[model samples]
Target: MYLISGAECFDPSPRGQVDVLVAGGQVIAIVEPGTLNVDAEQIDARGKILVPGLVDALTHPCGGGGEGGFGNRTAEIDVETFVRAGVSAPVGALGTDSIGRSLDVLYGNVMGMRTQGLNAFMLSGAYRVPAPSLTGDIARDIYLVAPVVGVGEVAIADHRGTQPTAQELRRLAAETQLGGILGGEGGTVLVHVGAGDSRLALLREAIEGSDLAPSVLYPTHVNRSTALLDEAADWALRGGFVDITVSTTKELIAAGDITAEQALRRLLEAGAPAEKITMSSDAGGSLPVYVDGELVGLTAASPGSLSDLLRALFADHADLFPLALAAMTRNPASALRLNAAGEIREGTRADLLLLDPAHGVDSLMCGGNWLLRHGEYLN
Candidate 1:
């Protein structure tokens, strides 16, 4: 058992100074400071703040890339990377190079992370249809595979995507929804929105022309372009969720692309519901640069980028910090329908992070086990 005392906790809803109790890898109770006494290791966090561990909704756990060939494939993510980034829960997916990467390998990576004390999940498929699956069918994969909650990172409107038609997308969404219903999981079709000219037209069509709920399709990387961001804001306004990627480079920003923070601000300013917005670190994926329709160079993305963005938001835009935090926390959890995640609540998994005076991660706990303490990896 463990007790965290006198910390300002955000049950993602900001409960003032409180003490949190953890046992059996779950949050057992939360009480006013000094209210409860128990035999447990105690830590005084009077000067710090505590928040639910951030969730990376769209990550390349087994590594992504390969747009530039096998030599360009990204490296697999290690446990320490997630600990340092304050990511306790991560949902993995394949990107452009799904052909080279197997779903089994991705599942292995997720299970490995789980063995190391991180709460992990995955999506089956890459940037195309028919989506690659372990059980040969996307719905069957979701229903039979324990870690698979949905099918995602499927590409659209991108040069690298299969450029699936509206009917194909509708079919994918319908099947994914059915799988979710049958498997008691979120059967989301995680769409990878690209910089192509079509923007979100196909997704719009899929939502309008089908019985699928607007929430069935989750479009990520919406901040890659101004027009796309605008479309994403409108989508959110109309009751859909949108995800902004935090793994953007300065070059992309210079080219008029918005950062995750910028995108969040835009979404809020444009009257989009804050609960409908999410942000994720497209970590371990390749950030390929294109010049005049040619692949010029590729660089790896980091999960820490999401933490960096959050730190900046906390420092510079304190008023927006809760909303931003929600984007990484409650929103993604709700969007993915993940149980006992994205919030620090009793009966939920005890995945939490502590912030020091500098607004950096001072300690992190995953499944009630300390993975990082005082800025050092415990393991």
Candidate 2:
């Protein structure tokens, strides 16, 4: 048993000055400060801020978007990177470059990370539909593979996309929806909405005309274009999740385009439900700026951007818990249906983080294992 005390807890209950008690990789209890009935190691977190570890639902932690393997493909995140960033959970997906990407690879990767005591899950396939998968079929993979929780990175409007027809979109959504049903998960045909004027009409039509729930079809990178974002906002109002990519301060500032912070503001101002909004780092994925069908500049995505977005939002005077943290934690968990995560509470897995008052991660615990303490990793 362990007692983590002297911190404000962001458990959705949002209790201040409480102590968390963890036993065997789960939050055994949460109580008023100084209240506990067990002998345990102690972590004095006085004056520190405590928050549920963040969740990245749409990261390409499988290694993505770049050519070359081993040396060139980005390595999957270690426990330390996640802990240091206050991310206790990562929901991975593959991106545009799909060679060497497979369901088996994603499955094995998620298992390896979970074994090291982080809550890791993955969405199978990549930017093309008829998406890449394992077990030979999407539904079978979801049922047989523990980590194959969903399918996506299905590119839509980008030049890199398959430019699938509406019939193709409906077919894919139906297939994915069936996979989720048989697998007891939110089998989302997670779409990669793009910057074209076509926007998400195909998705809207499928949801309206079919039996699939609107919540099951997630659209990421909505902030990639201004007009496309307007479509995303409308989709959110109709009950779908929109994922904005995180940015470095420089990238966010220079973007002059929509940012996660600005998107959140605009999303809320447009009456998009706060909980319906999420943000992903798009880490290890590529951010390419194109002109006249030419690549002008390309920057590799980094896991570091997750924390960077939070810190930048702090400067904007936004509320951290309900707004920023939800995008990182609860929203993703809800979208992925990762049980007992995205919030800190009794009986939940102890996937929690301690942050400085300014919200920088200071320590992290995933599944009750302290991978990082005072900024150091046990692993």
| Top-lDDT candidate index | 1
lDDT score for residue 257 of model 1 = 74
Clash pairs, model 1 backbone? none
Worst 10 residues of 2 by lDDT: 247-256
Tell me the deviation in Å of residue 352 in model 1: 0.9
Model 2 clash pairs are: none
TM-score per prediction, in order, is 0.96, 0.90
User: RMSD of model 1, in Å?
Assistant: 2.1
Q: Which ten residues in a row have the lowest lDDT in candidate 1?
A: 287-296
TM-score of 1: 0.96
User: How does residue 340 of candidate 2 score in lDDT?
Assistant: 60
lDDT of 1 by residue, 71-127 (tens): 888899998999899999899998888768888889999999989988899998889
Model 2, 215-265: lDDT tens per residue? 878898888667777788899898888888874335434554577777778
Candidate 2 at 230: error in angstroms?
A: 1.9
Query: What are the candidates' C-alpha RMSDs?
Result: 2.1, 3.1
